[model samples]
Target: MPVTVSIAEFFSSLHVSGQVGVTREALLPGDSEQTQALLSRAFQDACDDLPGGLKADLECCHAAATAAIHYLYRVCQALVDRAMSEEQVAAICAAMPPLPTSPGEMFSQDLALRHLPELWSMARSMSDSDPLVTGIEQAALRFPLSSVGIALKNSPDLLSLRRHDGLWRLYIDRIIARQDALRLEDASTALAVADALGEHAHSLAPKLAARLALASAPALSAPSILSLHP
Candidate 1:
């Protein structure tokens, strides 16, 4: 029931060079083996940096990594085709591993899902009306810590704020990186995250505080300033 083929044979069988200028290989570039090796290395690197308790849970990490890769591949295919039905989106979402509970588990899972925001943004740009975009948005929001770079519609729930210092620091760093693109709600959420971090906020405070101040500042006309002077 199962068939196995070498990577070269598989690519050759696809007949990638024909009247159709675009090929599956063009859609998903890079050697299959190399891609798998890269994913494996990334997973291992994340595991190495994980906390002692989480480092031992390789099974959970492996599952998360596999889910993330599968989700990415499926979503990318849909994006390339520019035709993802609501049913397809639903199926993809249903296939995702459920969000884990513990902070350690959450962090481990986010190591892979952190790349979702960029894909979500691409989907949004492609067609906000598309169900696929909505599905991707929901997925990104579900992993709040990983989706900090996204211009959130609303603040992440309080439970997301309960992350450990490392996750909080990562969140703040992403927020800082996206500071220029932050919307009003995004800035408000960043301020709340900073408040939660307290002393840990460190350099994030000045940057966020200044941005908030600028956002709250009212625009003044020359006439209004002249009237005030008179």
Candidate 2:
């Protein structure tokens, strides 16, 4: 059975007396219902003041964590029941590699690779209004291998898509420029390229914003923005 944690108990567990050196054991002098009630009321008041959106986000994060814990618990329980050897368990675990990039990616990969219906169901409970969460859900729906594309015979420099016969046909759009760089005619071309990128321009927004905001800003210099990556 799951243990229920009361607000008073939760606060008592903190035991943050610092220099006073107050321990959790010292907090509870006796079984005082009034003290517990007061602590619970204080906790409720603090929670009530928090923003609704933030609270919802916290709840969603909690749900995802709980789902992951449930998955790990089941895996451990199954291994123990089967009396699997330590080496066998290690070998099975070795197949699923970890991604240190982000937690969102990690959870999405877990849901996809484990094929956990309950985990996905829990994730779907969160609101899809956020783009970050939407990206995660889309990733979870597809197989992990599908996300990790197979090796290509030839690496292409550019990919293009055009509308032909009411269908979007994709093709390679390659142009060899002088010294592999775009020689902009004027500021108009630069502005046009920036406009075409749209939201993608925000990728350098932080760096640009920081430079502009500096008190002793250095002379401005433009970098090649038309570079393509594989």
Per-residue alpha-carbon lDDT of candidate 2 for residues 1-230, written as tens digits (9 for 90 to 100) = 43343323433432232112122221222344643454445334433533331222111122232233233333333233345444543443343333313333333233223333332333345433422223333432232211222112223211111111111100100111111113121233233333433454336343322322342256558864787898
* Cα lDDT over the full model 2: 0.30
State how far residue 41 of model 2 sits from its true place (Å).
Answer: 1.5
lDDT of 1 by residue, 161-228 (tens): 44454555556556655652353356545565556446644465565556566765788755553445
Q: Which stretches of candidate 1 lie above 4 Å from their native place?
A: 1-44, 47-60, 158-161, 180-211, 214-230
Candidate 1, residue 179: the lDDT equals 56
Cα lDDT, all candidates: 0.55, 0.30
TM-scores for all candidates? Answer: 0.58, 0.18
Error of 1 at 23 (Å): 9.5
Q: Give the lowest summed-lDDT range of ten residues in model 1.
A: 14-23
Report how far residue 94 has shifted in candidate 1, in Å.
4.9
Who wins the lDDT comparison?
1
